[model samples]
Target: MLGDDGAGPLLAEKMLANPLEHWHVIDGGSTPENVVHQIRQLKPSLLLIVDATEMGLMPGDIRFVDPDLIAELFLMNTHNMPLNFLIEQLRDDISEILFLGIQPDIVGFYYPMTDAVKKAVEQIYQALNLHYIQKAFEPLAICEQ
Candidate 1:
């Protein structure tokens, strides 16, 4: 799973490149509950949350968080949680989780992603040993497990 507009689309593309992995994207525009509901339904083994809110990330740099840690952070910060809640509530359901956040150079209406964000995406793909796949990929299971 992936969320946040800053790097969500890019990460989704990278995950799709790996034929063995399946990815679902939830952007900032979606309500928080919608993302939480999807996580409940999919029961994904991992989650990649790319956001600017996480601490210690430089504009061109990246940060990684264990899914469990993210869940704690969410509970402490937002009264309503993001997908991290599911990771906590269903820890056994997840194999591993990574929160990949980039400090975006700019985030504004009618603006394209900064070069730094785009380059970071490429770096993440290399780190994950994946290539861009140019076709439809598998859908995340919509029914509850």
Candidate 2:
């Protein structure tokens, strides 16, 4: 949870209910170094970052971003954190790394989330159980292979 206000709380709720069941909430008041230290110590299998960014799908939209961008951000932001080195750093630890974002209508001060973002949060929570094949990119047709 990287946001300063409402986004953090909403994401915390969803993560608490997540089937995988590990949740940590760090207050935005904390310094980035504190955050980096905590992550290093815990070594979470999946680091789901919910931040205010220009990137990502709007409310009610979901998409898997290329992992390369993920690596770039982690490196530049966290003082060359190990995740910057290679996806393999997470390979032995994390199996899935997801960045669930809600395009913020407001950030930095407390304000109610936009109706669209709120609806999206709920939708994502409900859809968490939808079965997705573990490897969806595999060729399904013989000719394609």
User: What's each prediction's clash count?
Assistant: 0, 0
Q: Score every model by TM-score.
A: 0.56, 0.49
Tens digit of lDDT per residue, candidate 1, span 90-135?
5565666555655566655556777777777767666554533211
Q: Which segments of candidate 2 are over 4 A away from where they belong?
A: 1-5, 15-48, 56-60, 71-92, 131-145
Error of 1 at 98 (Å): 2.1
The residue-by-residue lDDT of candidate 2 on 24-136, one tens digit each, is 65433223233555655677766655433333334434333345565544312222233334444444566665544444544433455677656655654554435332232
- In candidate 2, position 49 carries an lDDT of 52
lDDT leader: 1
lDDT of 1: 0.52
Clashing pairs in 2: none
